[model samples]
Target: MLEMLDNPQLVKIHFETHDDLVLVWANGAPPLVAEFVQVKGAEADKLWSVADLCLRKKQAVGSSIFEKSLDRDQHEETACFRIVTLRPVVSALTPLTYKRGNEARAIDCDEMVALKADLDGRMPNVVSKRGNGTGYWLDNCQWDARHDEVAVKTHNRMRLFEIMQAAGSLLLLEHIDILLDELRKLVKTAGDAKWKPDKAKKILTRKAFLTMWDACLAKLKDDAAQPSGGKLIEKMSNASLTGTVVAMAVDMRLDYARSVRTSRYMQPDEASQLQGRVKSEVQNLSAKRAAGTLDLDGPAFHALCVDRMDAINASLPADQGDRSAFLKGCMYDIADRCLLRFDRTGL
Candidate 1:
């Protein structure tokens, strides 16, 4: 599924079909190619052999793994086949392993002769009736093995994280968990039994999948933008803040308010003057943010505000210049009062 998402050429995925999965690829119109995939979860110690592939339940004709893989040969569109498993293949099938530049593996002379002879004796009509010879089927078949379920999940998570980063998603790890769960539910729903036109519901098209992905990302961003309760916290929420910074912002807002009430080390006039300066700087930063001249994201925006406040403190008269922390608190107090906003304008 991760592979399907990564490939731009993939058009649709059909789950629980004649094959375990069918990946349809097309450039524009009707001449789509289908890659039929048969997924098998083999025992930990098992290795797939020629005999295993040729075996059929009740020794029935057209029921062997190879025959089932070729069933789609009767379809109009070009077809390729794959047997994806959790166990490795024996020596004769080693050439079918999926690797870079090795999507298809042709049977060698010796193995082809022996295997073809055996299959012909078991299912001669099936071999002779293929539009292309049995050799073509063998050449197009791929055997991809050792796909451990747990390892695949880990890989898919890493792939999803990369996708989020590429999309500039502000979501964190917990959010990724939520998104993955939602996506799994979507896959399960798509896998449910449905016929003909309704089977369209069973097929996940790339365009539709991407639309859902984009909508999920947009909702996460919207949810993050909503006010998170306390006055200062609400202001910080606009900035997309979380964890320690939010707690720190709350503390700063309270301390700055307390200092204003008691006039701890500074006079009332000094506090008022400092407040005006902080407001001026914030306005300037807000303008820059609006103009898109500052490209910083949420946390970077917060850090930039802190640095600007520290610079403001340094420029003040000696006694005032020493109170950098107090100035930072003053900034948060201004935010609490709605006189300052950490987020970019119109964002």
Candidate 2:
């Protein structure tokens, strides 16, 4: 599928007996020595193995050469050849021949621009670093191949992670509403005259809540920046990336809620009620997951949480009283935590 074309731009190649050479040809065309040359005679087959070893070892140290001198006299070319190890071949004219042949015709700005555009379309960004050396060959033939594979795997993992984060976020928001409802009832039953139901919405929109959400979002953004993998095994392991993202979201929510309560809004009794319910939920979910009784997928976890919320609501007092605002805050905390964990971990 690959082809080479010649243009007015001159390219000269010099042969070096000290180093290995590969004769590249078009798919249907005969092997023609333009600038590069094939092995003198019997060394042709060894070219492939040498290329492979060069790429693998990342060194130019030569091993034994494959030669046909055993059966053939110094003059004749023989088909049969064998590999042998020795020091690298060196010749007096190798350097001079290469230096002279590297010179090419000067190009005007227009031609240079066009040529650069052509190359940009064909090669990856990394390939532009090499002009016309062995480094270019290594970049295009070896490193680029590996990089492409890693890029694909990384993208897949990030895609799955995003899905999990989104689902978890939705679940947490719903749970937030349930927690608020429960909190209102608890406040009312307490007969705490100081509690203000009217201020609940204001509290929900407080700077503290916004700050916590911002922190959680920042963490998610950082996760999104994780690099991709190159190996097949790594790509396949991305199956669990989504779950891991979800778990992290849950952890962020829990930590934020705790920070809010402990730092600026200390309400031990109210916070304790919310925390207790969440602790119980986690324990129950953990047991269920361990026993293979609950599925961690979106539908299953959401349904179970909804049922639990209904039960929690029914158990609360009829009137939320003056503590309605406090209850709503607690609910918000619990819901976010539950949603995050259930969404990702499937528990």
Clashing pairs in 1: none
Highest-scoring model, TM-score: 1
lDDT of 2 by residue, 154-230 (tens): 44334433333443432122223333344345334332322255333222212333354446555544432232121
Tens digit of per-residue lDDT, candidate 1, span 129-151: 34665566676777888558788
TM-scores for all candidates: the values are: 0.60, 0.22
Q: What are the lDDT figures for the candidates, one per model?
A: 0.71, 0.33
- Relative to the unseen true structure, what is the Cα RMSD of model 1? 15.5
Error of 2 at 277 (Å): 1.4
Candidate 2 residue spans exceeding 4 A from truth: 1-267, 320-340, 343-347
Candidate 1 stretches with Cα past 4 Å from truth are: 27-30, 42-44, 99-125, 128-130, 167-171, 228-347
The local lDDT score (0 to 100) that residue 45 gets in candidate 2 is 29
